[model samples]
Target: METITNRTLNLHEAWFWHEEEDRLRCRLCAHNCLIAPDRSGICRVRKNIDGKLYSLNYGRLIAAHLDPIEKKPFNHFLPGTQSFSIATPGCNLACDWCQNWQISQADEVGSLTRIPEVDPKKVVQAALEFNAASIAYTYTEPVVFYEFARDTALLAREAGLKNIFVTNGLITPEANADLVTWLDAANVDIKAFDQDVYRKYMHGSLEPVLETCKALKAAGIWLEITTLLVPGVNDDPLQLQNLAQFIANDLGTDTPWHISRYYPQYKFDSPPTSLKGIEKAEHLARMAGLRYVYPGNTASSTQTVCPSCGKLLVDRDGYRTVLNELDDGRCPRCNTEIAGNWA
Candidate 1:
C-alpha cells in the first residue's frame, strides 16, 4: 500500500494506553475514550490500529484565517495584534452551543467538506506569509490534532512566531505538560463552574478543565479565560461569583476573564444573554478580586482601565483598539507595569 503522507494514520501519542480487549484507551482528556480495533476515539481524530493509537487528522488543515488576538479574548497578552488562525476537524467535547459546529461536529470519516490537506511546514509558511505575529490553533480542539500542532509549533517557534491554543481546557495533566512546552499563550473556555452543568450541557467533566487552567498558569503561559453566559443556563449570579472567585484564587487576579454575551444558536436557542446580565457579571468579577474583566460580543463600556491611576489603558471600539496609556508594557500615567505585551 502506498503511504498516504498527507493523511497518515498519525494517531496520538499523549492520550492513550493499550487495553486488554485489544483496544486503546485515550487519556488525552477526561473522556478516556476506549477505542476498539480499527475504531476511532470520541474526538473522531485518534484511531486504534492494531492496538496502537494514531491521530488521523495530523496536518489536515481545514480552515485558516487572520484574526485579531483580542478575538481570542486574550486582552492581557497581545492587544490588537493579528494572529494566523488554523484548525483541523474533531473536538474532545461535544458542547451543544458550539459556534463552529459545522467544522467541529464532523463525522469520523471526514466526508462533511472538501478540506485542504496542509502540512506543518506549510502552516508555518502561511503564518509568515500573512505577517501574523502568531499562529492560533483554534475553531476546533487543537489537542485532538496534537502531532500536527506540535510539528507546526516547532517550526513556528523557529520562525519567531508564537503559538496559541484556543481550547476547551478539558485536557489531562500529562497532555497539558507535553503541550505547554510548545504553546505560548492560550484562551481556555471555562464553559461553567458547575460540575453538573458540564456533565449535562458539555458532555464532559469540569474538574479536568479546572486542572488544565492551573497547570497552564504553572507552566508560565499567558493564560486567559472566556465564559459564554447562556441565559437560563449557567447564568446564575452565584455561579458567576464562584467562577470569578476560582479565577481570582486559583488562576490569580491578573488573569484576564472575558464574559461573553451568549446568543441563541446551535442546540440551545433560549435567548441571548442580556447586556445588563453581562455588566452584572463584570461587577461581580471585580468584587471577587479579579483585576482584569472584559465584556465581549457587544460594544459595551468594557475598556481596559488602569487599576492604579484610573486611566483608560486601551480603548477598544468594537475590536479596533487604540493603545493610549501603555508605554512598552507599562501604564504611562502611573508607571504601573501592565500585564500585557505591547509590542
Candidate 2:
C-alpha cells in the first residue's frame, strides 16, 4: 500500500455548496447542514472557513484494506472479486449502533492528532497493485469524503477498475447524480423502514435513503440493499415486511436484500440479533417477491439460488465462491437470467 508521511493535506472545496447569510449550505447529503464561519457541520468533517465549504477529511484515510466484494454483502454484483476498501474519518449520520464508530466518529479538532493522508492517484494505484477488481469507498460514509472518493473513482475508472460505494443511502439527489457518473455498484444500508426509528436511533430520516436507492437504480448502478436486524429495535415483522415490499416493488424484485445480524456496539446495548430473527427477515423478503435474499453475520450459507429453477447457481462459504450452475449470468438449469455483473 502507498503511504504518505504528511499528516494533513490542503482542504478540498466541497461539492453542492451555496452561499447563505455569508455562510455555506452544504447540500452533500440529506442533512443539508448550514455552517457558519469556522464551524463544522453535523458530520464534523465539513467545515465553513471564511464563507467557503471545505471537506476536512478529504484524502485523509483512517482505514484501508482489501476485502472480498461479498463482505460488502453484494450477492449479484461481481460475486467473487476482491475490492480495495478505504474510508475517511467522519460520517454524516450519528447512528448509536455504528459498527465502525471508532473511526467513523473520530474527532480530530479537540486533539492534536492527525490521520494518514493519501492522494487520489495513489489510491487508484494501490487498487491496481493489489489486483483488486474494484475500489470500495466503505467502512464509513463515503458521502462525507465526496471529493476524495469522486477523484479516486474517476482515476480508477480510467485504470480499468470498477468503483463501489458501501454507503448509508442518505446522500442528496444532486450529489448522488454526480457520484453515479463513475460509480459502478453500491451496497446501500436502508437501516429501517420506519421514519421514527430512523430519527430516534440513526439521527436521520428514511425518505432520503429510499430516494437514494431509486436514484442509483435509475442511474444504472448495480445496487444491493442491506438492513441490520437489531434485536427489538428494527426487527419488528411489520417493519421488515414494509421494507421488503419497498425493495421488491420499487427497487425491483431482482435487487439483492441482505438481512445482516446486528451486534451490540457503541451506544446500542440491545442483545445481538437472533438467528431466528435473521431467518424470519429473510423469509419475509422472499415472500415480498424479492428474488435474492441472504442472511449475513450468521452461520447460514450465502448461496445464490435461481428463483425460477430452485437450483443453486453460486455457492458461497464466507467469501469463497464456487459457481456451480451459472452460465455466464444465467441459471444453467432453467436458463433464467440472474441480475448481476457476473462476467
Clashing pairs in 2: none
Off by over 4 Å in 1: 1-16, 112-114
Would you list the C-alpha lDDT of every candidate in the order shown?
A: 0.82, 0.87
Q: Residue by residue across 1-343, what tens digits does model 1's lDDT show?
A: 2232224443334444557677778877778888888777788777777667777776667788999887876777677778999988889888888888878887766432245457789888988998899999998898888778888999999999999999999887877888999899999999998999998988889998999999999999989999998887788889999999999999999889999988776787887888999889999999999889989998764578888888888887776676556888888888888776667
Among all windows of ten consecutive residues in candidate 1, which has the lowest summed lDDT? Answer: 1-10
Residue ranges of candidate 2 with Cα displaced over 4 Å:
1-9, 110-113
The CA lDDT at 111 in model 2 is 18
Q: What does the lDDT read for residue 150 in candidate 1?
A: 88
lDDT of 2 by residue, 1-343 (tens): 2221123446678889899987889899999988888788998888887678878888888889999889987778777889999998888888999999998888846311366568999999989999999999999899999999999999999999999999999888989889899999999999989999999999999999999999999899999999999987788999999999899888999999989988889998888988988988988988899988988888767888888979988998877676656898888889999998997
Top candidate when judged by TM-score against the true structure:
2
Which run of 10 residues does model 2 get worst, by summed lDDT? 1-10
What's the residue-level lDDT of 108 in candidate 1?
A: 62
